[model samples]
Target chain A: MNAFTRFASLFGAGKDASGRGGSSPECRRVGEVLQMYLDGEFDGDTSWLTDHLDECADCGLDSAEFQQLKDAISRLGQPDTDTRQRLQEFADHLAGGEMDVVDDPV
Target chain B: MEAAQTERDAAFRSYVVPELDVMFRVAMSLTRNKADAEDLVQDALVRAYRAIDRFDGRYPRAWLLTILRNAQINRTRRRRPELLHDPDTEMERLSSTKSGDEFDPEAVVIDPVFDASVRQALDALPKKFRRPVELVDLGGLSYQEAADDMGVPVGTVMSRLHRARKRMRDHLEQTGFGTREID
Candidate 1:
């Protein structure tokens, strides 16, 4: 493990941790599984989290809040079509080419 | 040099041009400022051109994002002096979390304050946690991909990502708007 990983391992093991199958490969917690869920990596019914989410209202709320947060974060930083044109012109100049794509673009 | 530029221009047109919006959005997610995002995207585009020869041309968006992420980091590292250590100060102001005393996620569908809350919560994360979250959550990189990009284990990525999200939720809970754990 790298220094950061080792540091994380030292200080990172305890907050809100409710893991299963400790010291085993299949071990996962609400935190880890919830990460997968937000990443769209959770295999739905096949995921180990399925059972936990069904039984734990807290985890269920965690799931919903994470989904909502993901949507919120995803909706940020939207750029219009003109942004592409502007960036392309910038790239052209950065490429040692003239700014011929968009005339007099600032 | 001229001939290589010509070839790079063609390759860039084919591979990179289509992904400008993705790069911009990813830049915005990191910078949280339109002006900064634009500047970062321009830097990344320049770096991408310089490194375009190394890219295999598939997964153009991913390739550009990697470049953009690195550019942002380098920029952050360079500008960070002892007096200006915290790079997030500027971003936090842009999101302006002053109104998050009652940040409601459900009520945030059209609320800028809720938007600020989410961004502020992300800003509050430790570097170890935030990097993976930004890579996987914001940049849409996969576990293995984020692991490789961040040079950490896949388990580490998952661990940090989940921890970061949990912390974000906890912050939202503190804001008096989101659901809190039943304890």
Candidate 2:
């Protein structure tokens, strides 16, 4: 237990050593799963996160934290009226003309 | 003068003026400086005007962007380089906090310091990483859209995005926030 605590403090309990307080291996694994989960990329590996989370406390915490953070960041990044207007103008400009693509046919 | 006037008048108005803001924003993301961005956008507009009559009108935004990107690249190739300091690394050095200053959780994260750091970090990246980061994250185009724009497969976009995001996070860590959760 002492050695484990030491390992946790030194290596951040499996968190990144780069000063981002490396997350646990379990957390990283969970993060990978969550990426696939949110992307809906895996219909086959349905029980991965479920079974992993059941055993990994750190991963569970990381998952919850990541979800919350994702939500917050998404809200912060949501397009505002001005941004939308800008994009609309861009779209309109795009509708005005096509670019000439030079072809090299031998 | 009449010919020039006629050409200028017909060269375009709605697109030239209306798209300026979008062009400026994209340029800003690419150049990371307002003056340079403005210059690049202007050059791109001029180039676009020259080619506008021949344009196919298939994908105007992508086409314009390609020209703008090319202009930016051209300018970079010709221009003398300026010295840049990576703010992320500097921020990391200052993370000591011996002064006991606390970062505000509610303060805007897009402040000049963070923005400059992000810009610098992004500029430090290779062109391969820079492209997807510029397209997907800053430009807010979807993967398929960017794929079409870049003439690459969607998987390539995904790969570039994954690498770019990882590189960005790594850059952030190296500069400051070493081990701090970015998201």
Write one digit per residue (lDDT tens) for candidate 1, span B3-112.
87688888888888777776877787677665678889987777777677778878787678778888988888877455332446654554443542222334333555
lDDT of each: 0.64, 0.52
**Alpha carbon lDDT at B59, candidate 2:** 61
Calculate the i-RMS of every candidate, to one decimal place: 10.9, 11.4
TM-score of each: 0.64, 0.51
Question: Which segments of candidate 2 are over 4 A away from where they belong?
Answer: A1-106, B1-21, B81-110, B178-183
Docking class of 1: incorrect
Please compute DockQ, using alpha carbons, for every candidate against the native two-chain complex.
0.22, 0.07
Q: Highest DockQ: which candidate?
A: 1
- Tens digit per residue, CA lDDT, model 2, A1-106: 2211222343333442322222667557666556435434445766767776555545543344333322322222233344445444543453344422212111
Quality of candidate 1 docking, DockQ: 0.22
Off by over 4 Å in 1: A1-34, A43-60, A80-85, A88-97, A100-106, B1-6, B58-66, B73-109, B178-183
lDDT, residue B104, model 1: 32
Worst 10 residues of 2 chain A by lDDT: A97-106
